[model samples]
Target: MTTWTYAELAPDFRYWLREGLPVGLPGVVAVSLDGGGHYARRFEDAPPALTVEATDFLLPLQPPVLYGDAQGLAVRLTDTGRAFDDCEVVFQAESPGFMLWTIHTGPLADANHVVRVPALPDGRAIRMISGVEVTCIENRDFADPTRPERTAVGASRR
Candidate 1:
């Protein structure tokens, strides 16, 4: 049984969504929620290993749903839209916050392909994609086992 929290697995999940799934990675898949209150599996190469439906939620507005099955686990966010298939997502996580780096490789490659989303505890998780930055309110603090005092937030070249 694995005991990794959403904070710990978030970066890996984002990477898988941004990039393609590696050969043998067997963990939870992450899905972003759209404004319509529906959960979508964005990655074409690797879809959600588990079955996740919006009816699973107790309420229509509730978000950040987690589902696990024989295949693995999945976390679906209710406020974000589908991740762009042509962008490469890189993320860094720490206590209290996490950052997502998206690199666009499509026709917009000539434009600013790099965008960052900085998440703060009890603050806003910014979503920057396609030249638009949307802010979503976060309810809880991100907790990382490695660092208890402060969570690191930044983007680095991969």
Candidate 2:
């Protein structure tokens, strides 16, 4: 399974996320696709692909919170543009309610994000006020097999 430490996103990422810039955080997001299905092992396997890459952004948040059972991050877009097209994650289950924890990003949403995170409280969804327009969610199964924790946000390591 995957084990990691909780670190904040880089300063630039945090800024975009907070300000709602859609250009996306500038950086290379790499994950393993193969090798043995173990810790940091996906860097090897291909084809049936052990790694997945995406144009990732740092969603905004006030401050992060880690519940006794789980941890979560929330963000809203600064740019008032088209809604998100689609978001895909590695923990494949068709919809939001499987073994994978869920993050919800949508339109005209206020930090009044109780609908998506019905399991949690309304104030629980992370939020930021900025220039662009977007919504972002990041959920964690604190004890899952695939959360990327090795990457550092800025030049500094926490």
Candidate 3:
């Protein structure tokens, strides 16, 4: 299994945080890591300064079920018909184990979108994205520990 250290991803994470991500949405910030790890935050209504509330996880990497990017390393879950209009689902692998994904809905669209990240089968922890420090936690920490039989050991997984 490949072990990932924060030192490797710190630069990219800091860069993303400083640039405010590449998201086109006005008040949404979304990021995903490899092994089914995804994070998203949407502000209620429209606020000048956004306070992010996020939900994230680490799960086994699954097949591309929805949308695949040009290189086939990224996949999205949004409908191809109204991708940019309503909501956006995106998952891109930055490197081998370093990946990021996003799901953003427009300001006028329904904000109740549900993102389900499968559980980590090896009982390891996944890293959380932060501007100042690097943090890692297990799937059981979130109060839900539904695990699979196999796990994908990415760079972020210890």
Model 1 residue pairs with clashes: 18-89
Give the TM-score comparing model 2 with the true structure, all chains together.
0.19
For model 1, the superposed segments whose C-alpha errors exceed 4 Å read: 1-14, 18-20, 36-49, 58-158
Error of 1 at 122 (Å): 23
Kindly give the stretch of ten consecutive residues in candidate 3 with the minimal lDDT sum. 148-157
Question: lDDT score, residue 61, model 1?
Answer: 25
TM-scores, all candidates, are: 0.21, 0.19, 0.20
lDDT string for model 3 (30-78, tens) is 3444433434343223334433222233333222233223323222232
Summarize candidate 1's per-residue lDDT along 36-152 as a digit string, tens digits.
222222222333354655453212222233334443322333323322223222333333345444333332212223333333456543332212222221111222222111111
* Per-residue lDDT of candidate 2, residues 1-158 (tens digit): 23221122453332212212223322222332222111221111122323433323232322222122234433222223322222211112212233343343433223322222233444343332222222232222212224432211111011
- Number of clashes found in candidate 2: 17
Native-vs-model 3 lDDT? 0.30
RMSD of each: 19.3, 17.9, 17.5
Better of 1 and 2 by TM-score: 1
Runs with alpha carbons beyond 4 Å of true place in candidate 3: 1-18, 21-26, 45-55, 61-158
RMSD of 1: 19.3
Clash count of each predicted structure: 1, 17, 3
Against the hidden true structure, what lDDT does model 1 obtain?
0.30
